[model samples]
Target: HKHLVQALRKAPQTAAVGFRQTVQKLAIVVELLLGDIPERAIFRQAPLRKALAPYFQLTQAVRLGNLQRFGEVLENFGPQFRTDHTFTLILRLRQNVIKTAIRSIGLSYSRISPKDIARKLGLDSAEDAEFIVAKAIRDGVIEATLDPEKG
Candidate 1:
């Protein structure tokens, strides 16, 4: 991603038209989605920040695990994401979304049932919640245990 940004920087000033800059912006979005770059890395640049406002919102949604806002952003920018070929990559952040939700749940409650977690995270089932919770624990996103008997 950095290399792509650098190459864009090296492009002749005459070629720095809207199209080329849009490509640069899309590349930056790809990097951000992959967690390969920080928001500040792009937002510090006024042009890129202004050009990529929608992507920034998407980033914010992902970070906060605001699945509703995430859906809104995707719905609003579906064409742009699809055009840039980032729709699938953005979809891959589901795990991060679930992890962020689990982290928040861990902080807010000492003990929560898999059923409650499933509902809170908008998951389809308690088993899915259990798998996500276990993954979150294994990934060090949260510290919790499952009580299958109690559940």
Candidate 2:
């Protein structure tokens, strides 16, 4: 707590740095408190779940697929939040899923075949993946080329 206070004092104007630092400190505290407890025992503690609800709420805000909203949530509540490994994995997976969806639709980065895109995006339905691709094309976010013979 003393170190956090000192850090906050050192950079009073930078919200990003301050938020990250505070979250890291909170994570450390949580890890220390729950590290030795069995998973079953930890889950049985209803108060712990209640206390962590705000963190989960913020995570859901981040996963809403908007960078601005994510940044705002981080800036607003990051200081009071701590997340476990499961949450971290969920966040990472969400990011990857979005990236894959974007790239699969050919609206981001490199171009890829539709089949490959569907696989990368983990879409069970090729038609659904094609819908995404078609939407990107319609929105002028991506362009498709035809072979000379096909054209």
Candidate 3:
């Protein structure tokens, strides 16, 4: 667990890959913890869903780039969050989508035209797709730029 936390702090360049690996490690830890308990006794123990609240909160803070809040969430609720499946899935989905979007957009940020995004995502029109793209940029999911030459 200490090693996992340390790795997360290092901020590897492959953020998505690193994040997924961290989650897998954490899941392993949770499984190990529950291994000794009888299957029937599991429910009688603290609800796994309740235990994960803190972790999910921390993950949200991290995604928003609020380092201070992220640290605080980890410090306060990290243990419980590790055990929660719902929170873990939410974070996993968020990470996966961001990674997929980044890979879809190539070298030229300006090359990612609104039409391209909309068509790829199967949206009704470019305008609707652009709206979603704009929102993603605002949310820090991806960066966008306009090139005078392309225009």
Worst 10 residues of 3 by lDDT: 35-44
Among the numbered candidates, top lDDT falls to 1
Each prediction's RMSD over C-alphas, in Å, is 2.8, 13.5, 14.5
* Superior candidate under TM-score, 1 versus 3: 1
Q: Candidate 1 residues 15-44, lDDT tens each? A: 565655576666756665564444566654
Q: What is the lDDT of residue 58 in candidate 3?
A: 42
Q: Which candidate comes out best when scored by TM-score?
A: 1
Off by over 4 Å in 3: 1-99, 106-109, 146-151
The TM-score, computed over Cα atoms with residue i paired to residue i, of candidate 3 is 0.32
Query: Which scores better on lDDT, 1 or 3?
Result: 1
Candidate 3: lDDT of 102? Answer: 44
lDDT of 3 at 80: 54
Per-residue CA lDDT of model 2 for 31-132, tens digit only, reads: 323321112333233434555454444444333434345445556655544343333433343343343345434555454555565666666765655676
lDDT of 2 at 24: 41
Listed in order, each prediction's TM-score against the native is 0.79, 0.30, 0.32
Least well predicted 10-residue stretch by lDDT in candidate 1: 35-44
Steric clashes per prediction: 0, 0, 2
Clashing pairs in 2: none
